[model samples]
Structures are given as structure tokens and as C-alpha cells.
Target: MPSVLEIRWIMRPASLLVVVAAACVGEPDSSPWSVADSAGVRVVEIAVEPVALPVYASVGELEFTVGSIDGTDGPAFGDVGEVRSLPGGDVLVTESRSQTVGVYDRSGRTLARMGGRGDGPGEFRFLHVAGVAGDTLWIWDPIPQRLTPLSRSGRVWPVVTFEHELADRPGDLRRLADGGFVARTRFQPLDPLDPKYAESKVWTDSLVLRRLDAEGLEIDTIAIAAAEQLLREIWPSPTGEGDGRPVGAMLPFGTQAHWAIDSIGNSVVVDGTSGQMVLRDVRGSIRTVVRFASPPRPLPEAEVERLRRSRLDDVESSPFRPMVERVFSKELLPTAFPRVGGLLVGESGTIWVAQYATFPEEVTEWTAFAPDGEPLGRLSLPARFQAREFGEAYVLGAHTDEFGVQRVQRYRLERP
Candidate 1:
């Protein structure tokens, strides 16, 4: 077994910025852990076990401020997409609205502003914050299909073109351990009944994850997509339509996608969106699979309605409210709750799988798993905060105020 020192540097310079974590001391347990409740799924035995309670209150409260909002020369996020912890207790955030990336310290002071929106060298036409590779920050702009490296000192490295010859559009782009990249492609939806969808260019789909080398060439297949078919519109509508839906009504809901890459670039993918969590290593092979012992039952009709109503209450005002009502129709909610709503890979190789809340106002539950595929404990987050990145003790996520102002917040978790 590799020593903790080796595992700590699995991704090396690329991962050094994510977190300068303490090495996990000890060898991995090779014995398989089985569960009758998991439909006979195979597991692995690890020395670690659950040491905490079932719920972690105040975690979602966003009261513990490890990082704050900066509006000066730093970052005032109009639309926050991703947040990541840096080496020196700093954090990196991607603001999609303004097409910029900023680095902030624990006190919320701006360490550096990487780049702004533009078509020039440092200017980003399609801003995509990939990951930290030592002093180089990898950003991919899929529109121009280029991977541009931003130096730690704010210089633009030579652009690496992504000659994406795939049949599907790519979604999640994770820079891998060997300087390669792993991407999620969109799956093509079936024939569209609406004329507007006849040529939907930006709808999201992917039944499999693809890996590319450092040069942006296809290397291997990470994991196969779920068997389930879900059509999610990607592009936003002009005015009346929300999320590419028609002005008055919406199309069928798509499957919620949740996956996380560990410090080494190995991914934890939620299979079937419910039954299984597949752990694929850097070699594009399934190292061990993690299954939930007692999975929650699908949401019942009443619960589904309650969820829908909860959303309706959130709309402060809508000029298209009347139009939305006239044609507003929806397919039945998925029988089960979202298989997996969110995923976070801890710096220590632990996994946090977040389940969807019936409503945004309710608490969110997360199943924790050890590095060796052992199901640790579960925690219930007190409220809604869309977590973008996490560390040993804090969750840095995007939170919208009651007034609809977006802010990047850091919520510290107290196990007690």
C-alpha cells in the first residue's frame, strides 16, 4: 500500500492549491464489506467508522464565516458557479456572471483577481475555472474550445486548444492527475414535441464521462452514464421561458447530475442516481463501489406536490406569471427523491453525498463515505446552501439571500 506521504501528493502541484491537507496515515484495508440492505453489493473494509451523530445542525446556517464577500478590487459575485480552497487557507471562486475568477483569503480579503471577461489573451470569451495546478490555474472556454492557463502572478499562459471531436457537448471538465482532463458529455434527447426544441443547441446530456490527456486528446472513459434517460434543457430562455422552457409552461424535468473528483482526480460518481456510488480511480477503473445501506424511498405524490408548491412561493414577482399559469404543465415528479443532488470529495479522500431536499427550505441530508469505500456517518444540514467546495471543516458554497442577492459564504461544520 502507498504511504500517506505518497497519497498526499497523488495529484501533486495540481492538487497542492486545493488543500495542503494532513496525510492520512496507514495502509488501506483490502477486505470487502458487504451489506444485505444493498442488494448484495460488494464493499471494502476500512478501519474508520462513524464517530458522529446523524445530523449536523447549523452547518447550512452559513453563520461561521471563514470567508466573506469582497466588493473592492476583489470579487462581488453576481453569479457564483464554483468555490475551491487554496493552499494558504485562501479560496478560489469563479463568478460566471461577470466571467471572472478571484482568490480570497480566510478573512475574505482579495488575494488576486485572475482574469476578466474578454476575447483577448487573459480575456475570457467562455469562462470556465478548471482547477489549480501548482501556480497555474487551468480555465477552459468550450465555446472557443481552448484551455488557457493563468499563472499565479496573473499572466496568461499559451492557450491549449481543445479539439473536441465528440458527438456530444461536454459539461463538467475536471483536470486530471496526469495533466489530462475528464469531461461529462451530454446525451441526445429523444424527438422533441415542441418546435422550439427542434434545434436545441445547448441542452445538457451525458451517459458517460470521457478522459483527455494533457494535450486535450481523448485518453480513456471514466465512467458510463446512468441507464436512465433524462432531458434537461441547458440554455436559458429569452424572457417568458425559464431554463429553456416555453413562456407559460416547462418541459419535463431532467435527472440531477452529481459527481465529485478527489484530490487525486479520481471521481466518485453516483450510479442510478439512487442505488450505487461508483468510485473510479485515476486509471479509469472502478476501484471500489459504495452503496447506501438504507436508501430513502421515492417521494410520494403529496410530497411531490409540497415540493412544487415550495418553489412557487419563491418567485417574488413574475411578469409572465399569467402566461406561465396558462400553459404551465409538468410531468409527474420522479417517484424517488433525487438520487443524488450534490457531491463533494474531501481533501482526505472522504466523500460527501448530498441528497435533495423536498424543498429548498428544508434540511439537506448527506451520506459520508470513507476513502476505502466504507459508509461512515450521515449528517443533516440545517438549511439550503448550494455547496461548491469544501475542506476539512468548512463548506464554501453559493448562497442567495432572501432578497435574491448572491453571495459566496463559508459555513463551518461543528460535529458536536
Candidate 2:
């Protein structure tokens, strides 16, 4: 009988096999499965349908150009978490590794670096995310699990820490129209013996979206099981070792995934690994699955049987194994890519999606789309950029290496 490695090689398409083999560089059995070619790329040929409201043009382009923003010494600004725009055209950036939120002007010059890694009044143990509302800046520190509010003038207020049952780790915080803010909490791992095998086994677990009032009280919650199922269906399952145990089960993965809320409180949750996005209406009863991609084809029955009979050691050390891991790695896995990277819902119900692409040098680009899912233009930048919203402006938080020094750049959009 042929070995499991041989069977996997035979099942993979010729074109994909060559690509995988090249990536493996003579390594044994590294390739897993070939993803659908159509996955990850944008949907370009869908027919437009009429809705209750008018369908306006929803596509725009992003003309992003890199700028010089110097503040802080080398190694000061680390990996960026969130880039938020203030009311007066300034941008606030959370340096997760450096434990500081660097404030910058619209032109990319740093004005201030707020807070460090500490437990003091203004300090943050771990800065996970950030947002801006009027003159206030909200930073989420997961270690302390509190929201640290800072004034534009750099005065720190008493932290808003919620009860553990309300939210263990805060995801994203957005300002509401009613002077309150909405906070999102991710799903936690249930008891290992729980019957929900799939939820507990997956690295990126499902998430639960919760709305918080000004007093940090939980006002509402949205179950994301449907979204999780949808994403799993879209991405190929990691290789199952003997006894059919998935490799991802042992790896640490993020659970917050992606989330966004509109002016009317409608929420869109994205599970990139599953290629599924769930849109929940304000009433919560209205849930719709937005399918963006398809998973790789499964192995044939004969091939499956061959793999089952193959020796464990021979299979584990095969070149095809690395290929499988590479195909499923977040970088190459088509299902792991987000359909729309940075999503924002406008007050007028205009849904804007930033198509994000990241390259090896930390370069990133974002393409904008209208609320009706129309393609807008694209934004290209030289650094890593994450989307943030503040009132009418769209903020792009970026991290770049300038002559061996790390810097943060805030790019704000002036919508026409």
C-alpha cells in the first residue's frame, strides 16, 4: 500500500503540489490540502439587488502614502494595537509591546507617548485595544481587565473595571450615540469535559458580543455560535494526527477574531478562520450568515483509508506534513484571511470595509467599500495599519521601521 504521504501528494492538484513542494524546500510531507482558488479574493461578479433603502455607490479607493512621524527613541513604539483619530485631527496609537499610547498629529509627528507598563493610576499592564470619543481616549488593558480613560490633555481618570462575570477580557470599545459606549467580550473556554467538543477543541474559540453601558454594566449579549460554525466550514481543518486529533487544538489562538457595530447597534462579527461573518440586527432575532469563501476539498475515501493504514512515524515526519502546516498557517491559509479587514458602519447606515493585505516587510494596504458592499478605492501604506473609527473620521494606526527605529503613524481620512 502507498504511504499516507504518497496519498496526500496524489490527492493534491499538480499545480498546488509544485507550489507546496517549492515552499517545503526538500522537506518531507509538509503540504496538507489545496485551498479553493476562489477563496480569499473579493467577490466581484455578484448581481446587485434592490433593498428597502436606496442602493448608492459603495466603492472607493484608498491612496495611502507613507509619511515621516518621529517621536521616541529606537524600540520605543512596539507592535501597534489600535490607531484612533481624535476630534481635532490627532491620532492615538496603542503600543502593545511598549506599554504606551503614542499620540500623533495628522501629518504623522508624535506629540506624546502616554503611560507605561505598570499598575499605577495611568499605567497599563497590557494594552489590548484603544478608541477615541470627543476629548476622551479609552484603552483596554487585559491584565487588569479595565478600561483606562485619558483626556486629550493627558490626565488619567479612574479606571473602569467591570465584574469578572460581565467580561473577562474586553475586545473593542466604541462610542454610542447616547453618550455611553459599547464593549465587546470574547467567548471563554468552557469546562474541558463540556459536550461542545468543537468549540473547546478549536484554537480560536467562538466569541460572545456584549454591549456595555456608561457605568460598565452589561446591557446585551449576542451568541456567535453561528458565526463560528460558518468560519470552520470555510477553512480546511488542520491535519488530524492518529486518532483524528487536530493540530490546532494544541496551539494558542486568538478568540476575539473581529467585530464591528453600526450607529443603530447592529453588529457584524467575523470569524476569519471559518470564512464566515455573522450580521446581527438590533433586535437580535435577525441573524444572517455572510459566506465569503469555501474550504479545501476533502481527501477521497480510498486516500483516507490509505492514510489510516500508514505508519504513524512515517506519516509524522513526511514532507507532506510541513506542506499541510504551511497551507493552514494564518499567512497562506485562504480561509484565515478576512473578507474585509477593517469594517465600519456609518451613522447614515453606510458600511465601509477596508480590504487589508499584509506583506513580509510589515507593509499593509486597505481598500474601501460602500455600505451596500460596493467596492471603493484602496489605501496603501508602508507600515502595519489597523482601522479605527471616531465620529466622521476613519483612523489608520501604523507601525514602521525607520532607519532601525520604530515609529507609529496615524492616518486620518477626510471623507469627501
Candidate 3:
């Protein structure tokens, strides 16, 4: 395993970062778990047994909620991007509709509001509260392609800009342990002149995750994983004046790659086909592989049909609704559910993997693994609650009411 060791230079005028490869100290385990050394790298393989019981039945104590539909307190968020709990009882929320970040107390009272709809240094076009580093919060704006630092007291710091190529619609922005960041460049534009572009229904490619320093400079290129397959159909323009436009969404029930950044700045990738997870360091070296023994469950046809109908209803108001309807069908759905749905790494370095759920009425199962790859058992929560951040004692999530009003909710993490 390679460990980072900072050493000051005696003769040189500047400091240099060095990585030292350490020798493996532990012995290999038998059958279910094993450790091996390959090409100067330590690899730990864990074969996890199927967990039968959940650690918690419901983790909902409802510590606090901040939002409303009546617009009574100006906290009526239109499209909430992210939520993070502060050091005290304050909660930071990002609303893309207003391009604002609102800080609220535990009682849902607004403490401070920052940013607005503009392209200025402090303003935002598509604002998202990415993560917090010490007393500063990092805000991601993909439209103008920049990361703006905001203080807890609503102070705006110097903005960090990115190159146009690197900032063109990146995926998730994860904060590193050393105050850096990693952004995943998800898609590659299709060539319009290519014959395959007109004939292909599903396009598959690789996604590149780039690592940037705290100053927003590209420092290293991280791992490349399979991108989500696009399910699209070519539709002629409504005006019938130009080339056909490709209208589609990510393929439902398709096997793709899901990843999360650990507390120590390592990247963990897992393909949805199975319960295998690959852990790599910042230099993109495979350090470990965690695999669960359970196989994928068979997906019911009725459930697939239900999901298709739900997706069609979501795009009912779109102009490409007809093309989307043609793209979503039972035949296009996978026969078995993806073993891994999503991945989340807690602030304590504990890894949580969520099970795939097709509907809100279903129960979402999350299995936690230690930093060393030991299974910590599973937990269950309502599918309606979308968890944004998970800590040892609490989970911050977004809950939508029956009237479609968004609310930031903090729930106590209850375990047996």
C-alpha cells in the first residue's frame, strides 16, 4: 500500500509531495477473505455473507425540517440541490430554482441566505452546495463552471474557475480529505456525421473522473469506469426544419458503474451487475475488492411495467414524450435487479451501499462496511426519503410531501 509522507527538502527551495510504498504487514486470510500483493500493490479481497436482518427498522426520529409549500417564510424551496448539517444546529440548503443557498436553524428558521440568479463572483446560475471543508462550504456551479467558497456567516470567498473542457457538465463533486476535489466527467458527445449515431439506440462509453487541487487546477486523472448507457430515439424537430434530435434518458435497470469517495480521498467503484466493489487510491491503484456473496434477485415483470408507466408520467409534459414512451418498455427492462444500487461514504469513513428500489413504497436497504472492508450489517429506510449525507448518529435527507413540496429533513440514526 502506498502512503503519503510529507518530507521537507533540505537543499531545494520548494516542498515536494512524495508517496512511499509500504510493505504489507498482515498475513492472508483463508477462503472468504484473502490478502495478496500484486505489482507493488496490496490487495484485500473480502467475500461477504448475505445479511438476513437489518440493523434498524426505521431511522426516522425527525430532528428537524426546513421547507414549506405555502411560501410563508421564504424557505419554500423550488428545486433543492443538496443539504448539509453544520457544526451547530444550522443546516445549509441549495435551491437551484432561485440559485441561492439558505442556512436555517433547527427550528426551520432562516439564519442567512447567500447567492442569487446571476453570473457575478458570488452569484450562481446552477448552484449546488457540494461539501464542506473546515469552516468553508464549496458550492458547485456547472453552468459557469466554478467552485465558490462560502463562509458559515454568509461570506463569499474568492471563486475558483475551471477550464471549459473540464467543466462541461461534470457529474458528482466530491471533497477530498486534503481539501481538494474530484469531479467525474460523465459523457462524451456523439458525432452527428457518424452513421452509427443515427442507427445506435444505446450508446455505451467510459466516464473519466478528474482530480483537482484546492485551487481548482487539474492535478491528476483518476479512474475511468463505464458510463451509464443512454436509451434514446431520434425524433424530427417539431418545426421540421433541421436534423432529428436525440431524446432519451439513462436506461432504467441497466448495469452501470456507481462510485463514492471515502473519507481518506480514495475512490470506490462498483458495477451494478453484482455486489463487487473496487477501491482505489488517488493515484488510481486498486487497493481492495469487497464482494458480497448474494446474487441478484429476479425482477418481476409487473414491477418493470409499473416503473415504465411512472417514467412516462414524469415526461408527460415534454415535447419528446412520444419518443420517451417508445424508449421505455418492458422488453427494454433488465430481467434481474442490480445487486448494488448506490454508494455513500460517511464522514467517519464507513461505506454504505444502498439496495435498488423501484418505487417509493418499497423499503430501501443499506449495508455498511467498515474502512477495512468488514461488513457492519444492513439498515432499512423508507424509499421516499432521499438521503444526502450520512453520519454515525444522523442522516440528512430530502423529503417531499404529497403536494410535491420539498423539505430538508434530518433524521436520527437508530440502530439495534
RMSD (Å) per prediction: 8.3, 16.6, 7.6
Write model 1 residue lDDT over 122-163, tens digit each, in one string.
Answer: 767667777787878888777766678887666788887766
Models 1 onward score TM values of 0.70, 0.57, 0.80
| Model 3 Cα shift for residue 416 (angstroms) | 3.9
lDDT of 2 by residue, 1-416 (tens): 54222233344336534654574566433422112223333232211211111222221334232233343332245466666556676666676676887666655565766888888888988775445667777777766767888887778888887653564456556655554556655567534333454332343455666666667677777545522321221122356433233233212112225677664456766553443445555544334454432332332444333323442334587634543343233432332333333455544444444433322233244433333232233444434444444233344445445464444443445532
lDDT of each: 0.59, 0.48, 0.70
Shift in Å, residue 139, candidate 3: 1.2
Model 3 spans with C-alpha error above 4 angstroms: 1-60, 69-74, 117-121, 163-169, 187-189, 233-244, 360-363
Q: Which residue pairs in candidate 1 have backbone atoms (N, alpha carbon, C) closer than 3 angstroms, thus clashing? A: 13-134, 33-43, 186-205, 186-206, 187-205, 187-206, 207-225, 273-339, 298-336
Report the poorest 10 consecutive residues by lDDT, candidate 3: 12-21
lDDT of 2 at 203: 35
